[model samples]
Target: MSDAAAPGQPVLADLTTIGVGGPAVRLVEPTTGDELLAAARDAFTSDEPWFVLGGGSNLVVADDGFDGTVIRVATRGIEVLSETDDGVRIRVAAGHPWDDLVAETVARGWSGIEALSGIPGSVGASPVQNIGAYGQEVSATVVSADFLDADTLEFVRVPRANMGLAYRTSVFKAGQSHPARPGVITAVEFELHNGGGVSEPVAYAQLASALGVALGDRVPVADVRDRVLALRASKGMVLDPADADTRSCGSFFTNPIVSPEALEGVPADAPRWESSPEAQDVAVPLGELPAPPPPPAPAAVKLSAAWLIEHSGIPRGFSLPGSRAAISSKHTLAITNRGGATAAEVTELARFVQSRVASEFGVLLHPEPILLGAFL
Candidate 1:
């Protein structure tokens, strides 16, 4: 329904929070579920490359631009499927803004996602990345999702168990390749409890400290949401048109999870957390138990990418030669578009950072954003 040169038309730069990338050849904004399905099917059947866009917070497209159709999901709806003494189950449209839904649920005393406040992107994108912050990930609350599998040309209800949700990836993220032939998420369902103004046990240390509570203590949900928003704003994680630091794909790299042997030669004070065991062990049916466990494997460790970058000598606000794109002034983890930046510039900066980190620590940092025609 839209072209790149139409009056007030949107380019990738306008659509993305990073404010970079070239225009799409054609863009379709579908406002209904049926329309979304039809648009996806049309693009798939035509055998042309296509991309699905949500809030456009986690993308970096190439300067040459996409030559295929782009489907912008704009559909919106939320319905409570049922409520019980234990909790409530609700279904949300894929196009819904993630933070808005968090705010709404928090306002109504929902306990599952208060820690996810101020995250950018859409509800549908959450499961793809297993979006998490302050120690709470979408994988914890997701019950199921209604996905249109373009490969099979059928709608399938994928339960959380089948989603392959991990630290920050799922089957959906794996299917990002062949975009026109990938499964299209239509809606997601969540189960949240009525916590009576209280929150789930505080998990992240920074959040606990912000609320003046000890780790593992529960606080008021409203307090948690407010403090989370304030904390995110401080790091420029929340969107603000005037703040150059906020003009980024949030957290450009994921924390690297490595085997115990990979931690050699790193500084003693480097931030690291123990990685959880693989899901298969915990996901087995309740009554079915595996035989006696084999000897324990070396514990996997998750290292902080921000710590690695700073220690590797790349400081905040660092930029490549003659490029407007730079590391966020507020946080070492973000690569920001400091106005008039191009996708190539962003890519250049990212690659430079990765090289520095790898050279200093022997670990290559991988980008967290979805790259379209752009590579590090």
Candidate 2:
């Protein structure tokens, strides 16, 4: 194990983005996969609680802190494994900053992940959440991941198909019920097209509007990155130390998906989108003849959590009495720490938001971040 894993470790407040967690009993920074495996073994065999930390961008730890080992994956490397006619295949270590890799791929004119620019956290955490934005999810391009299976205590390579990747979760994120199946992602491989200078077709409407192009039009990859960065900064999604609004977990809640029956009491004007049965009741393009309808199918609808919060009388920047945490002034979806907020304060604000939305709309907003010794 690395020397940092010794006693008298730094507080988790210095490790996470929101800056609110308490001290860890022991902190280990593993610079190699073997070192990481050894550290995990030592902690597990000793019957001590342990947690793996990545960029710490998407976690909220309790103020009382954890009384166990904290392994910080600090291994670093990026290797080009192959360049086929279809695309380039590369493996990135878990410690590599996610946005830096996106920038590198864009600079090299790779097409698949150009739209994922400016997201925080590490590559290993991406598959855990199946991270996505502006219509592109990391699951789309992942070839496989190398992980240490806690069950066997051995290294294994799992293909993307077996990862159980869904909207914002995977099998790696199993809860307490799967105690014997804990796994730590070591690295991820991706397949990206050599698009020369172009990017994948613009798939999100807001992004297309920002670039002054129609949906599905491919623009320069560099331009896509710049536009995405500008858009994220506008909403305080980009990380900036001087910006208080950026001191958040990006979007605090995932867009809630509901069945059609659940929408009966919802307002007609509420912002929603079709999540399943893609062509269900959708209008055809002008001047195009409508094709024969397929058999009726069930549809899943996605509702905007921000809209629910705002309509439930919780505006942007809303905070409870004397709480140091407040919703982001730029976006209702984010809860930010004004300064010196505690984990309890953040949890209180989140619970308040969830209660208000649920009471008003019968929809409970679930937190997107992985809560550590904290809940909403």
The per-prediction tally of clashing pairs is: 0, 1
Instruction: Write the residue-wise lDDT of candidate 1 on 307-361 in tens digits.
Output: 9999999999999889999999999999999989988888888888877887788
Give the TM-score of each candidate: 0.91, 0.90
* Model 2: pairs clashing at backbone N, Cα or C within 3 Å: 5-27
* Worst-scoring 10-residue span by lDDT in model 1: 278-287
- Give residue 239's error in model 2 in angstroms: 0.9
For model 2, the stretches where C-alpha displacement exceeds 4 angstroms are: 1-7, 174-181, 277-297, 374-376
153-211 per-residue lDDT for model 2 (tens digits)? 77889999988776676777744112224768889999999878699999999999999
Give each model's whole-structure lDDT: 0.83, 0.82
Determine the backbone clash count of candidate 2: 1
Question: Model 1 residue 342 lDDT?
Answer: 86
For model 1, state the Cα shift of residue 273 in Å: 0.9
